[model samples]
Structures are given as structure tokens and as C-alpha cells.
Target chain A: MIQFYDLAGARDDQRLSPYCWRTRLALEHKGLSYDAIAWRFTEKDLIAFTGQGACPVIVDNGKAVHDSWAIMEYLEATYPAHPFFDSPQAKAHALFIKHWTEQVLHVGLTKQVVLDVHDMLADRDKPHFRSTREQRLGMTLEAFSADRDAVLPAFRAALSPLRTTLQKIPFVSGERPSYADYIVFGGFQWARVSSERDVLEPSDPIYAWRESMLGLFGGLPAKTPARGAILAK
Target chain B: MIQFYDLAGARDDQRLSPYCWRTRLALEHKGLSYDAIAWRFTEKDLIAFTGQGACPVIVDNGKAVHDSWAIMEYLEATYPAHPFFDSPQAKAHALFIKHWTEQVLHVGLTKQVVLDVHDMLADRDKPHFRSTREQRLGMTLEAFSADRDAVLPAFRAALSPLRTTLQKIPFVSGERPSYADYIVFGGFQWARVSSERDVLEPSDPIYAWRESMLGLFGGLPAKTPARGAILAK
Candidate 1:
């Protein structure tokens, strides 16, 4: 059996982390059945027990896999019928995109979205959002905002390569969805589900691709009750 | 023919980066012949031609592979013999160690070493060090130092898991050397090469394991360059 660990009380519109979303979508795409566990950010003993302190960890047949990319690789290797990487060249391309998505695109998106989680969350969750942010980042709101703003330009510049790369390929690796698609999809879907509409409008092909992904996996049920909240934490 | 694009005079000691070493070592391990193009870090145009502003970008059979992990993956896929990932379970273990090496270990080693490059390279070449660092990080020495100090804790914490993981398995993925070994080798080797005595202390099984790797590959001409300066651009 496959087990997914996520955040509880997470809302569809307010669930904003791309990393968590990628695993959930992959499970759906592979048509894998799994149990879900919503974990609190501050209460990380469960994660530590597995020798990691991060979420979106997947456990399959008693083996625990942490890190989204590793988890995806595990799934692909274990279940070859629903292949995540088709060809050798395609696999290389997918790995490139996966690294680019995590190291570059994710950094930019996080800076843009993380600062406004309180405003993005439901009215009742504002205090919870603020507290969670403080706990995770160990910084006051003012400091966090400043730090976020400072990194925006670097983030923007880092994104230019990706934008150019994506323009050439239909998907991150072209045509069918590869691991790269799932990686980018996690972040883009988070922004689409959580942030206001206009946030992604300025970007053209990226926005279009994101909408297509949403339509593909929109039917899957929320993996955890707190996916949105877990992402926020 | 395989072609490697590397910086000509950079001091990326194992402590500073093991990614470069991984690629270099892989080339020797596979017993592949290739032309090595040593690049200066400040030479953005050269790196940009490869579509990334990073060292250790390799072009194999006309295909470009950037990022150390991706480059290694490309090598494993392209040259299946002397395989980097042997089995599904081994691949999973390799991916896990790769993630930890890149995300956790590399981050820390970069902080401890790159931040002090100016001081370390003062006798050798100041202008080159300054220019190279500026190009790689896009920041002045003062700014880079601050950034390095900030990320130190994360890097330090990265070691504990490695220590525990290494205790169980001789290599990161057990008996045979895989991509994980190469990746971790990059970071640990950097630390060792930069300073005989430094942050990543050569103690216990970690040091013993590294010595074993060096001894294992030490005989090959391709593995052991005449001088470190030849490869440091």
C-alpha cells in the first residue's frame, strides 16, 4: 500500500505549495491507491522518525521515500507500466526540467506567493497563517517581506532561462508528461489553486500549460484535508 | 567523443564542491576518452553557449548536459556499462543520496569554502578569484560572505544524516559506487583538496572511505591530473 503524508485542513483555493501538489498529481496519474496522513509543520516528530523533516513523503510497502524528486523516481522505477520517463533522451530532458523546476522556478514562485499567505487564506485562518509563517521562517512578517522582495530580481532572472527553455518544448520535456511536467505542475497548480487569478496572467505559454494540467487532474479528490494548510506551514 | 567543459583555474576543493569531481571521476571510471575545455568562471558567454552559467557542464555525443546530477544521469543512461545505478532499489537509493548530496551537503560545503575563497586564494590569484566568484554568485565578496554565513547551519545539519547513512553502507548506496558516491565525492573531495585540515574533518569512516576512493582511482592517468591547478579555472 502507498501512504501519503500531507497537511490537514488544507483548502483547494488556499493550497499553495507546488512540491506537495506534484506528488498528489503523480499518484492520481499513476492511478495508485494510497492512505493520506495530514501532518502539522511544528509537530515534526513523525517526519524525524523517518530521518527527514519535510512533508510530501511517500511510504510504499514499508519503504519510506522522502524528497519529491526521489519519490517520483521510486514510483517510476517500481511501476514501469505507467512510465514517468519513456526514452533515455526523454529521461535526461525530464531530469533537467526537474532540477530546473526545483532549483530555479520554485525559488521564484515561493518568493512571490509565500509573503501573502495570510491574505490568501480564509479570513478565519489569518492568525494561523501568520503564526505558521513565523514558526517556519523564524522571522517577523516585516523581515520576511523584505527578504522576499530582495530575492525577487534574482528569481525573475533565474526564471528567464526556464521561460526560454519551455518555449522550445511543448511540455518541460515536450509532448507527453514526464517527471518535469509533474515538478512544474506542482508549483503552478499551487499558485492556480491558491493565489488570485491575475498572479499568473502576465506569463503566456506557462499560464496556458498550467490551465491544461489543472483540467487533467482536477477530477482527483484532495489527497488530504489540510493540503492547503500543510503547504502554508 | 565525450567533451567536458570545466573552469580552468578555479579552486573547487572537495569541501567547496564535489559535483565537478563526480563528473571527472565518472569519466575515468567509464574509461572514456574526451577533450576537456577549461573555462574561466567570469566567461559567461562560454557557459551561456552551453545554456547554463555553471561549471562541470558536459557535452557527450553532441548532447549537452548541465547540473552535476543531470550530467551523471546522462552518463549512466548513455553509457550503461560500469553503471551508476544498477537496480530499481539501487536507483532509488542513489536518487535519495543524490538529493541529500546536492540539496544538503553541497549547500553547506559551498558556504564554508566559497565564502572564504578570497582568503584561500590570496597568494595564488586575487583578481581571478574575485572575478570568478562574482560571475558564479553575481555578488561582491562582502555580500557573498554574508550569504554563505547565513546558509551554514543548513550545511552543518546535512552532515549528521550522511554520517549515520555512511555508518551503515560503505558507499552512499552500499558496496558498489553509484551516482550517490560521485555526488557526495564532489562535496567531500572539495573540502579535502581545498585545505588538508578544515570544516569537513577527515575523521572516522568518512575520511577512511574517501581515502579508499582516492586510492582505488589514483592509478589511472585520467583520474590523477598532474596538478589541481590544471583543472581549476
Candidate 2:
């Protein structure tokens, strides 16, 4: 059994960390049974065994793996059933998608949901979250996202590439849901779990994809507690 | 031999279209011997048989194929010698990269090189090119790209995702070059072939990758003529 440490918010069930969601979905995709343990922002000591403070750390048969990307690689290499990547080139192509999600989708979503994330953090994690995030963003979370409403159109427009892509295929990895789908869905899942605001229009193809992703693995993602009824079927 | 209708500028050797560059590179990558015929923008009647006015059209064994993406598919299906895609999922993943290049990289490069492209086009192509482009951009090509210097930073910033990916791997498709690399390199090749301005700094990992791409296939890409000595080996 794999022990997965997922980041929690105010409630134990509120697993809002996008990277952790990627790992969770990947584990399920690989048909691996794992125990998901709730972790918090300030609980660096809890995951220190993995030599990193990040969530999405997995301990499999006493061997620890940290970082979502590394964990996915570890799972694929160790298990190798129901492969996450088709080949070396496929994995490499998926890496570009991973970078796109991180650099583009995650950056845009952070502005919309940073305030919500701060509000949903556990009391002990609040100070650490705000301080670290503020330092990186170079402003208070409120100020950083102050123009989110005005910038909403730009954020939506930035999704044109992804929108065009989903228009042609059912999933990011095509025909079947793969790690590429999970890589992108994790960003939306983060926003869905932490905020009530709707980032994607119902008309968007991504919205339909998200609905399918939520219903995967016996409604695994849909079962998570969220801020609102965002994941309702 | 494949009859490749490559886009040409004022000079017959100046093939500046990014889409054509993608097909050209794909042909070279597939080890296909092709007769490169210069085709101007207004030479629609020449390729009317393909039911399109695209310059990246190919005539192979009496079959006509147009559009860079579609042409790539035709080549891959017809000649499966050097597999362009490792698997179905790999091809699907490459499709996302294709969208990124079209939506993001090409958009930025167009703004930077539209004027250069206008100046390089044959006299017959100038009016058609400007009218269509201006209508789509909603401004004169010069007016739209007037703030090229001011917006250069943002254009470079948008490439952070590609830069990060290349930093980790030797090529866009991992250890070896694939259609993903050609898809992106096509955009850069557009700017490189039409303009004198250097978009990439020598320090960027993308610069190194571009150098490697130019050196591929016995310097096939390096052999193209340009307005400036941008491709100097």
C-alpha cells in the first residue's frame, strides 16, 4: 500500500493542493490502492521524512517519494500496469503540457483563488501561507488579486490554446484520460475546491472534460468536500 | 519524390511561413526526398486542386494534402519509415504542443515579424497579405506591432514554459527531436527567416535548442535564405 500525504485546508477532507490532487488522481489511474493522509501547510515536520515539505509525498513499501512529477514517475516505474505514459517521447510531450499547466493555467488560477486559499487554510497554516505567498507574489494576497475581476477576461482568453485543443479531442491525452488530463484537471480541481467563483463557463469544452474527470474512479474526485456545490453532478 | 509547395517571399529561396517550415522540417525528419517549389501567397490557383490556398501543400503520388498538421498526418500515414509519433497518445500529446505553438508562439512571433514579412513578400502578395492580416488584427500591421519594443518583455516572458522544459531535457520530445520540436521551431524559424531582430538571448536554453535544430538534417534548416544573416553558422 502507498501512503499518500495530501494537503488539507480547514477540514481534513478539503484536499485543495493542486499538486497533491495530480498525485492522487495518478495513483487512482494506475489502479494503485493508497492511504491518503491529511497534511497541512504548517506541518512541514510531517513530511520531512521525504526530505521536502511539499505535499503529494508518497511512501511505498517504506521508500519515500516527493514532488508530484517525481511521484508519478516513481509510480509508473514501480507499478508499470496501466501505464501513465505510452513511451519516452509521449512522456516528453506530456512534460510540455505539464509546463503549460504550471506556467499558464496555475498562474492565472492563483490570482483568482489565492484569497480563497488563505481564507480556507487552517489557523496554524494561515501565517505561514500568507508570509510565503506574499513574499513570492511581492504583495498581499488581497492586493495581488485585487484586479481579478477586471483580469478575468484575459485569464479566460489565455485558455484559447486549451479550448482549441479540447474541441478536437475528448481528453487532453486523447480518446482516453491519461496523466495529461490529470495534470490539467488538478489546476481546475484546486480552484473548484477552494473557491465558489466559477472560472470556466459551462459552454467551455473544458467544463465538460472536468465533469468527466470528476466522475472518474467511482466519483473519487467528486467525493471530496469543497467550498460550495461546484462539483455537483 | 514529394512535391512540396513551400511558401516564398520576394526571393524564391525565402521560405518564411511557419506552417511551411513545420512541414519542411517534418519531411527532413522523416528522411523523405522532396522537390521544394516556391509558392507565393497569391498562387492559390496553383494549389486549387487541394481545395485550399495553403502554402504547405504536398503532392505525393497524385494525392494532394494541405495544412501543416494535416500534411504531417498524411506523411506519417503514407510513409511510416521514421515514425513521427511513438503512439496514439504521443500523437495526441503532440497535438497540444501544436496548439501551443499556433496559439501562443506564433501569435507573439507574428506581432514581432509581421512588418518584416510584409516587406519580404512579393509585390503580388502584399495586398492580400496585409488586408487579411489587418482585418484579423483590427489594425494596420505596422500600427498593431508599433509597441514591439514595449511588449518584447511580455513576449519573452510567455516563453518561460518552453524555456523551463528545455532546461530539463535535451529536446522537446526528450532525448531525440520529434514533431513537437519542429512544431515550436517553425515559429522561431518564421521570425528568424523574416526579421533581423534576435528574439532569443544567447543565454536562454531555447537558444541552444534552436542552434541544435538548425544543425539538424545536414543543416537543412540552416540552408534557407533570410533577410539578414540570422542563420549564420
Candidate 3:
């Protein structure tokens, strides 16, 4: 079994890291079972073996791999029998979704739940997470999320590309869910597992896509405890 | 030969429509030759054969097709022999790039060249073109572009996703040029053909990718009389 280091909130069951979700969904998609090891932001020493300070690191037979993208690529290269091994072109195009989540979607979503993430962090993990986020955002967590409602419009607007894409096809990876779907889905999953706010309306195309995504792989994503809609609240 | 009704400005040789460029590149990608008929926005009657008022109508052997995305799909479906028939996953992911170009890149790039697009219009097409754009934008072209220089920073920042994606993969389609590249290239191509103001700096990764795209298809995009750095300003 793959020994995976997953990011955890205050509650051990609250797996809220978007990157970790990407890695989790990918492992499920590739039909690989793993022992999930819960790690918090304050526990950098836990994953020091990986030579990195991040969750979603997997140690498969003592071989450590970090970063969600690198982990997914590693899985695809290792397990070619499943749908993850599509093509270079698919990999290339999915890179756009990965970057979109990393650069755009995740940034917007983070504002909606910056404090919620703080609330869910282990007591020891709280201080460092808050100060680091404050430094990066140039404001306190309370001030940053003070006008979260104002951030909602732009957040929804940011999903326009994904919305428009879903209008034509059911999934980002096309007809069936692939790593592309998991990459973008990571944003919603992060928002869901981390916050109480409804990030998406039931009417949106993306919301519908998220519903279908939740049902995939025997409802693994849906079964998780999230503050938002597991299936469109 | 495929008869393509391409959008033109003051010069019949100038093909400035982003959608038309996607169709043109897709045609070239599939190794198909076509006679590009110069068309203007006012010449809605010209594409009446396709039951649309769009300039990207491609009539092949008396069968007409309109819309750049549809045309690329039609090309891939019809021309199955070439490198175009990759996989459904590639096509699915390409749709994201297409929508990203349409929804984000096109809108931002348009702000930079809205006035220039009017400036290059055929005399007969100018009034309606300016009026329609003004109606959509709720501002005169002059007012809209008065501070276009100010819009450049935000426009370039909006490209962070693309910049990060290109930093990893050479093309949006991955290892080689695909319809995804054409979708994005069309945006810059539209900007280049429409305006004298430079949009991207030479140091940008996108600039290098654009340079590579300019070299694609035997320098077809480079040979075109673009106002920007087709050959580095």
C-alpha cells in the first residue's frame, strides 16, 4: 500500500488541502489504495524525509514523491493501465487547468475561507498558518475575509472559463473524469472541505459538474465532511 | 479547395478575427489548403450560405461550416488521417483553452486593441463596428483606449495562468502545436494584426512561446503584417 502524507485540519477527518485532494482523487482514479497519514502545517518535521515542507507527499515502498502535479505524473507513469495515462496533449492541456487552479481558482477560493482554514487547523498549527497567510495576503485573516461576500462575485466570474467549458462537455477531461477533472475539482473540494459557505449555486453548470464529480469513485469526495454542499446544498 | 470567409479590415490581405485565425490554423494543422476570401463585419450577407453572420464560415465542396470551435471540430472529424485525430481527452481539454481564450484572453486583449480594431476597419465598416463595440462596452472607443497603457499591467497579470502553464509545457497542447495553441495564438494574432502597441514584453515566457508559434507552419503567422513583435518589434 502507498503511505500518503495528507494535509489535515483540526479534525483528523477534515482533509482540506486542495493539493492533497488532487493527489487523493488521482490515487482513487488510478485504483491505488494507500494509508493516509495526517499531517498539519506546523508539522514540517514529519515530512522532512521528503526534503519539502508540504502535504500530499507519498512514500511508496520507501520512495518519496512530493507535490500534487509530480505525484500525479508519477502515478500516471507508473500505472499506465488506468485512465490517468492519456497522452502528452492531454497532459499539456490539463496543465492549463492545474495552473488555473494554482494561480486563479485557488487564490479566489482562499479568500472565502482563509479564516475557516484557520478555524479548522490544529491548535498548534494555527499561529504559523495565520502569520504566513497574513504576510502573503498583506492583511490579517479577519480583515482579509471581512468582505468575503464582495469576493464572491469575482470568484464566480473567475469560473467563467470552466463554466463555459462545461456547457459544451460534461467533464474537463472530456466525457469521462480524468486528472484534468481532479485538478479543477480540487478547488471546489478545497472550498467544500474547508468552509461553511456555499461556493457554488445549484443553477451553475460547474455546480452540476461538481455534483457528478462527487458521485464518481463511489462518492469518495462526497463522503468527506465538508461545510459546503457535497451535492449542491 | 476549401473556401474560407475570413475577417478582414482595411486591407483585404489583413485577417484580424481571432476565431477566423483558429479555423485557419486548424486547417493548416490538418494539411488542408483553402482559398481565404476577405470579409468585413458589414459583409454579413457573404456568410449567408452558412446561415450565420460570422466571417469564419468555411465552405468545403459546397458544405458550409461556421464558428471557429465548430470548424476545428469539423476539421478533426473530417480529416482523420493527420495528427489531428489524437484523442477525445485532448479535444476535451482543448475546449478549456478555447473557452479560456474566448472568455478571458479575448476580452482582455480586446481592451488593448478596441480602438485599433476600429482604426483598421474598412471605411464602410467603421461606423457600425465602432457603434456596436461602444454599445457592448458602454464607452466610446477613444474613451476605452485612452488609458490602454494602464490596462496593460492587469492584462499581463491576467495571463499568469497561461504564463505558468507555458513555463512547464512548450505548448498549451503539450509537446507540439495543436488546436489549443491556435485558440490562444488567435488572441495575440488578433492583437498583433490590429494594433501597433506591444502587448507582451520580450522577457515573458509567453513572448518566447509566441515566437515559437510565429515560426509554426513555415512562418505563416510571422509572415503576416502584424504590428507587434512577430519578429521581436
For candidate 2, give the lDDT.
Answer: 0.90
| Candidate rank order under lDDT | 2, 3, 1
* Per-residue lDDT of candidate 2, residues B1-233 (tens digit): 99999999888888888899889999998888899999998889999998878889999988889999999999898889998888889989888888889888999988888998898889999999999999999999989999998888899999988999999999999999989899999999888889988789999999999999989999878888656773453
Q: Tell me the docking grade of candidate 3.
A: medium
Q: Of 1 and 3, which scores higher on lDDT?
A: 3
Error (Å) of candidate 1 at residue B99 is: 13
Best by lDDT: 2
Tell me the TM-score of each prediction against the true structure.
Answer: 0.50, 0.97, 0.96
Model 2 docking grade? high
Once fitted onto the true fold, the runs of candidate 2 whose alpha carbons sit more than 4 angstroms away are: A230-233, B230-233
Where does the lowest 10-residue lDDT sum fall in candidate 3 chain A? Answer: A224-233
What are the fnat scores of the candidates, in the order listed? 0.00, 0.84, 0.73
TM-score: which candidate is best?
A: 2
Across residues B28-131, which tens digit of lDDT does each residue of candidate 3 receive?
88888899899988888777777778779998888898888778778877887666537788888888887788888999988899888888889999998988
TM-score of model 2 vs. true structure? 0.97
